[model samples]
Target: MHISDQEILAMMAIPQQREEAFKLLVDKFSQRLYWHLRKMVVIHEDADDLLQNTFVKIWNNLDKFRGDSSLFTWLYRIATNEALNHLNKKRTELLNSFDDLENVMSGRLDEDPLFSGDEIQKRLQKAILSLPDKQRLVFNMKYFDNLKYEEMADILNTSVGALKASYFHAVKKIEALIDNELF
Candidate 1:
């Protein structure tokens, strides 16, 4: 969203005074951040948890947030770390197919409502979740999030070239997976 680091710094300057900036921050980038976490964890409840944790960490450590990167980048980095940690802690995995997910997601979707998709989304998500962690992260950030490689590089703490390569490999993997099933 291009919120400057200075703006974030100003908001983060006082721990007690950070509440005033809530609307500004939420107005700026909640949905994108939520989905960014969702694409990692694949459940509405988990996404919500991770999103809350990401913001909480940001709020708590905003003063520690260096302005060397853009505010969005900093938020993204936090989001990524929080999501990854949650996944690691839960050691939880998404169900492998439609039947289980459909039943489980019925109630969950009603509660949190991340996305509404028919068949295409299910297949797309299956393809995405099938990817290895780094590839999935690279693909989600580059493809779905439409983030620039340089910015993603900073958020992922990887070189831009490597992020580009990872994205390329991810696309190839998804294409091959889809093709093998359909074509």
Candidate 2:
């Protein structure tokens, strides 16, 4: 018989039983969460820093966590916000507006650290990087993360219907880019 996550979480709510539970969560989610951050920032060091920061936040916020959504949804919300905030701070450092930053990233795939991979996947990654930020987030959550629309809604703080529409548009844009070999 399997113990559900919520059951484990309940046990972990007691400070004495929390270490193993927290370790389990860290082990379970670290890589997937890290990759999520990597997809956005495209810098290995930055992703590593943000990944650690995300877990640190989880550790601090665990007690405050409302259990209103799944654990992954809560964590993804933190991770995504961390990634976006990192980008925004960096953008400000460069004295660029968010829109200006988007314009630059539109053509930046060839140089992004996170885009290092084999031919096909790298091509796909570049095309993904060309998308608007929300669309990229939606695509990553839906396609790579395999998150449901409901989970995405929680993480993004968007309605499920909006996520579906964003996903549809992202797929369409990717198809168009692929057809043109613009990746």
Tell me each candidate's TM-score.
0.80, 0.82
Cα displacement (angstroms), candidate 2, residue 149, comes to 1.5
Worst 10 residues of 1 by lDDT: 97-106
Give the per-residue lDDT of model 2 (tens digit) for 18-130. Answer: 88788878887898899899878776788899999999999988899888888878888899999989876877876844465655554565576555577777667778877
Q: Highest TM-score among the candidates is held by which one?
A: 2
Q: Per-model C-alpha lDDT, please?
A: 0.75, 0.82
Q: Which stretches of candidate 1 lie over 4 Å from their true place?
A: 1-5, 14-17, 92-115
Clashing pairs in 1: none
TM-score of 2: 0.82
User: What is the lDDT for 65 in model 1?
Assistant: 61
- Model 1, position 69, has a per-residue lDDT of 80
Strongest candidate by lDDT: 2
Q: What is the lDDT of candidate 2?
A: 0.82
Q: What's the lDDT for residue 177 in model 1?
A: 82
